[model samples]
Target: MPQIILGPSQTKKIDGSVKKAGYAFLEKLAADDAVPGLHIEPINGSADPRVRTGRVNDFYRAVLFKVQGQGDEAHYVYLGILPHDDAIAFAKTARLKVNPVNGIAELVKASEPVAAQPAAEAAPEGGHGAGGAAPQPPVHETEPAAEAWSLLETRGVDKEALLDLGIDAALADRAMEATSDDSLIAAVEAAPQWQALALIDLAGGKPVEDVRADLGIDRVELSGDEETDEELLAALQHDAAKLQFAFIEDDEELRKAIEDDDFAAWRVFLHPEQRRYATGGYNGAFRLSGGAGTGKTVVLLHRARLLAKRDPGARILLTTFNKVLADSLRTDLRRLDSSVPIASRLGEPGIYIAGVDSAVHSVIQMAGSEVGAAITEVLGSRSPSIGGRTPASNWLDAAATVPDLPEELRSTTFFQAEYSMVVLPERITTRDEYLRVRRPGRGVALDRRKRQLVWQVVEAYRARASVEGSIDYGELAAVAAAYLEKAGCGVVDHVLVDEGQDLEPAKWQFLRALVPEGPDDLFIAEDSHQRIYGQRVVLGRYGIRIVGRARRLTLNYRTTAENLRYAMAVLAGGEYLDMEGEEEDSALYRSARSGPEPELVPTDSLGDGLSEVAGRVQRWLDDGVAPETIGLLVRDARRAQELVQGLEEHDVPVRVVDAHRDVRPGRPLVMTMHRAKGMEFSRVVLFDVSHDTVPAAYAVDKLTEGDRADALLRERSLLYVAASRARDELVVVWRGQPSELLP
Candidate 1:
């Protein structure tokens, strides 16, 4: 077997190429590298002594390292792939070495060889490298090792300690001095992108492990009697957990990635910030929140694997809000570990993976409730709606014939809060029970007479549901939790909830009922900014406490800087809060990649709207973007349907996605922005963003002054979620007058 470690650029290309080409290419490349008899091309003046080249195909060549081994063992490190001449040119000048401090190998570009200074040339007066007017004097060049010493000297930053820590004192100094913060606090805040331990630790007051993990600087201990190629290659390849670079250790792992065309798994690896959450220890309930692409889901997957590994016989329940997301999690889990059995039944032993509804249904069934059919199933599947139309954000659709419904109590938002926050939570059944229930978060106060009328409305809803064999989702969870509280053991040992922000209080209560209160019993990953369901659940209210154990991840792995900025800009100046109502922190939230700024094009005419978008899609296809990598999002189901029809009419194959989509990749995906949560793609086109369609009028029409502001914020959040789904490219098209959301 050939050992090939790819750099970021090469890894990116290979990952993309593999998705397009399949596993046969990788198998061939590995086989080619194993043959020593092949004539590997040598660069004329390589900076890296081991640089070599080999043919990948007729038109392609690979640059690699022919690392000579101690005795008979040897291996190759894949540097990159390029056309023949370019491969040779890259190898000729690429300098390679292990960072003496960080212990990670890096490829450095050699400076162009300088011609010897002309013997007759006078030395500059000011400094050797100075230019322009006559230089004044010779000056000692400052070594980068003193970087920290110069800049941080006045900020109580210790220079000697950094030098001892193997940080380049000069580079550290320069980076710090370059930062705008003169004070230690401001300095750390300004320089989150860099890895300066002592200052960072002091600023954040974080524990040592977290600081090291964030810095990606593990204690590296290198030794004398440097091993030969076999030993070095063996260590580098096998112990990639510590290496800056990594090679494929299990061919099966590589095959699985290729088979699924999941290029994400083929990347260099998870960043340390992500890895820390995956492997961190938590005392009680743990919650992690981050914007999409920050690897919250990745951490949950890895954490599930780690927990399963800790105790071989552990019964873990990996769950989320919906079946599609649950299925996605299950798929990623299997990729992480094939042997770990996936329990088909909710309460079956081993790892029981399920959507919240499935698990709740199982709980109800086991509790002998013999649950009634949901109202939607009887009334014909209805999306959550307000005024019979499903609003893009958090509008509950529940209608029942109540005799003389109080004129003041017809608001769908009012009823949703009454049911989720007041009635079911208090387990109120009768009119008197409902009257006594405290509606804490309900803003509109009702007098005793009005409250009596509200109770009448609540009673009528329950009676109708009971008579029609109709039970809504919240009822299922409420009944199961009510049952779990009085009888039977909890369902699983641990509960891991993804997209926690979408979960309501009832669902949280059910999740709480499913697990015993203990250390690491409940794990939650959520970002309230993505809460399209309009569920603002303060976890602490539901008995799941993660106060001090909460961690925030700010670095985004998906969505480029340009796209991220555009996405974030939509929600900018909007007050988004955590479930707990604290202002969500996005200050450090940043992207690792940069691309062309998002294009917000307004169609000149209504007639050209759909056709213009179709033309843009074709252009992307011509640019070599796979149809599966592209997505189309609209504000509502009406527009989603129209967009899909428009694409098909234009001869563009398009898939209309819902929560239960099968996700056929080669077709452009079109869906309502609401349905695009918890999903991502390489390119996203958001169109039909008209003012009337965006902040659905009826949904916010009944809102109070304070409530209206929150409604608009939620609408912006929906757009933010849709826009952020695009990893590299974002095209937003609007017709007529653009939505007020357009800046």
Candidate 2:
């Protein structure tokens, strides 16, 4: 059978008609290579005769590399879709060959030189190799002297070492011309997988041997002249080569790829760092942390699929902070491979995906009447009917019963935090229990007398809640966890969590109770910089120990370098702690792509800011960017509605996205910054980030001075989350004074 291998060059900007036609071509080619409609033929001026262009339509053509195998099977590497002329031109210059140093397949430009050169003579006299000039720096910076020092040379990594690590001869010369880290990154972006990654590591001050060992490429050896087309075809099977090319096995896989016009091809291109964590085995709880766009969620999804594949009868539960993200995980899991079994519920021989709360609720529902008994065990009282009750309303009413309670302690924020962080996690039911429990992270201090008053308020609150058949989300999780613990915890064999940073202590306890403490039990992916929920949880206290099982990803594959810089700037050097109370290493994060610097537009008023947003979106539309690919994020739902109304006045079509309604087709998205988590867009506008509106007075108004810093950090994280959503372009609009969070 013929093989259809999809390359990473699949254009994200392809139009609907051309994408439809491209899918048809791939489907037909995968079914039978001899299909006449494909129109696969050699380019007339191609140096490598294997390069071919297939007809997607009359005007659009798909470029491919046809390699004949030893038997009847042939391998077709699909480059991308382009216009007829551009396809032919690109096909004529493209060469699919094996890297002589590392034995990995690489697609190179045939027009450029590929011969190896000595370290000292690679870039002679401030010039790159044959047919190439010295690379230039950024526009604002002046060119350095003829003897400008190279970062690689300073670190003892010469051109020969680069070539030995799989870099092409021409690329090694370009790399030797790099004087700064940014310039080195720019030069290596066009290199093959192993070569580019090795260069990136070296630029980051990693030793050459460390880079080789980390990438697992030290054992690979080859010679440039001994390689043949068959050998190059076999090289495509190497792990490094697969980072740029994915071989689609059958019609189903091809169909899945083409169904989503704006397909997520990045999921297929896993870096060595991510591939290891996703496929490797681990003991007990494992946590993967990274900044935005670092592919943490991608790793979690792949890990879930691997666990399912390894033990065919294993019951795996894949969950996140909310249903929308969980739904996304399910969809991506299917797209990752449609053959993976997806279970509708827990305790099944397949992957069960849901929100953490939803999973708890499912367990509660499954337990039925026994829920009351479990609730009784934790609350130290008879279980009342479980119903929705606003925690603020209950806390306020309960405070009224404790006249001697401190005015500061009466605040809803204090009570809510106290209940979630201390009471729920500890299952404190009596005044004695509340008095003995340690409030480690709380900003406020309370003596025995004050604790007694607080206990009175808690008692009153519970009595009222019991009478009204009301229970908060925290209590709900606590009950579910108790029920699971009493029932022996057979709901699932493994639990994989995404966005684990947002979960509170009760939810973590619930998650921990779902699986036994053993190998491959819990896999968590989170980023502290994206924690907008204001929950600073310590996972160790909740039975999820990850002291030595934690790892971090540093490279971002989604946002552009400029956008990532702007987003990280929004954090304003604020310290962000992970689930284990350790500071996150956010400074090491870098992006894989580069684009225009983020735009910050100041306006005189809210109306003017709205108009600016509308104009910018209109320009994006004129430039052929899809409406659904654009996002406008604000601080709250009210601001989102205001922006939607303002956009409508300007005749700009937009939709307000919430947990219930997702991004609509052919409409620009208007959503709160919190709702925009776990989502990405081609372009994003942080709409109306005014001085008074952000930091959102309500979030910090009633907080004590000691707690203000944490509240402010959460606000900064909100802006960071919004800024990182932009994959290509980012625009920040502020009316009057800008938010202090904006750097």
Clashes of 2: 0
Among these predictions, the greatest TM-score belongs to 2
Clash totals in order? 20, 0
Q: Write the per-residue lDDT of candidate 2 for residues 198-287, one digit (tens) a residue.
A: 776676667888777666664344544646667877788777777888887667767656666545455566776788899988888999
Off by over 4 Å in 1: 1-45, 50-76, 80-85, 110-213, 216-244, 256-268, 335-340, 369-408, 648-653, 704-707
Task: Give a tens-digit lDDT track for model 1, residues 1-743.
Answer: 56545433332345455343334445555666455434466677777677887665655566677776664434566554577677777678764443334343444444422111111332232111100111112223334555534334444444333433333333234334432222332323212122332344423234434444565654344454333444445444332223244565555654554445353342336666666777777788998888878889988887887788787667789999888888888877787767776777775666788889889878866755232222222222322121122121222222335445554456776677656776766666566666676766565677777777777665555544545554678877876776676664777887788988888788888889888888778889999788877546677888887778887877676887678777877877776778666779655466655567788888876457889888999999998888888989988888888888887788887888887667786788888887787788888988878776777786677765545666787788888999999998898888777877655
After superposition on all CA atoms, how large is the RMSD of candidate 1? Answer: 8.5
By summed lDDT, the worst window of 10 consecutive residues in model 2 runs over 127-136
Q: Counting only residues 3 or more apart in sequence or on different chains, how many pairs clash (N, Cα, C under 3 Å) in candidate 1? A: 20
Candidate 2 segments exceeding 4 Å error: 10-18, 34-45, 55-61, 117-161, 179-182, 205-210, 258-261
